[model samples]
Target: MFSEDPGARIEEVFRRIQEERMAGLPFINPALSVAAVGFARHGADWRGVLLTPWGIQLLLLPAVADWPVPPLLTRAFRQYPAGTFAFLPNHEKELGDYLACPLISDMHPFADQQTALATARACLIALDIPPVRSEAQPAAPASDGRRRFLGLDG
Candidate 1:
């Protein structure tokens, strides 16, 4: 109901929760945590979140600089294992470059350990190797004609 009438939807949700609270109901926390992070030698934090229907119960706090202790975001960041992390603007090249850096712990957004490992492996592979000669290797074509005279390859 957040489309045509956002106020009504918010009111309804609040009213339902209020009723549930009055009845001493338990809220099933509905949300999923997806993370996009940037990292440096020193620190990092989550850039965005992945949410599920139940997980939306999370009322996120502002960044730590502005917010008080016991912040929701603090808890979320803490939930992640201590290691590489950051909140970056969405850009694959930049993220890939960051991933390639040697100091990063390199675990990324995948829920599966293997998948995260794969990203690290891929990044490392990219950095360690030269680009493949996709356009065919440069050859001494008997002359530096730049372009073959009507393609002498025939």
Candidate 2:
């Protein structure tokens, strides 16, 4: 299934691996990140912003079980639209949260075009900083619904 969307393809590969290792097939949950994001410590941040009705369903459904994301991005997906979002992990981890960073083109450690494209397509709802030309843009409708969170808890 590896096609032009190498990143997406790779994500699928890793997901299958995870599913196999879990002793059973993967459930229908579009878990948007790595095994760590699913972990109790990171799941909340990863599931932060993009918790829409459809987004929620995609994430929790077995048909769309797609995650395997980068750790730094765990914060970015906090607000992206779940259905339209994608979190791409660099094949190389030494690069770390660097992102080859779309906004900072020259700042890349390794090219890894596929991974770069994947990073570009991640679930970023918004950012205090933007990616490179690439061109600056934002999703049409917010992943969030009626109201936004002020981060205050009762």
Per-candidate alpha-carbon RMSD to the true structure: 19.8, 16.7
Q: How far is candidate 2 from the true structure (C-alpha RMSD, Å)?
A: 16.7
Predictions in order: lDDT: 0.26, 0.28
Clash count per candidate: 9, 11
CA lDDT for candidate 2: 0.28
- Tens-digit lDDT track of model 2 for 1-154: 1112223332454445445553333332333332211211123222212111112111211112243345653523333222223333343332122112122222133234444334433323333223222245543344332122211111
Query: Lowest summed-lDDT stretch of 10 residues in model 2?
Result: 53-62
Each prediction's TM-score versus the true structure: 0.20, 0.21
- Of the candidates shown, which would achieve the greatest TM-score relative to the real structure? 2
C-alpha displacement of 116 in model 2, angstroms? 28
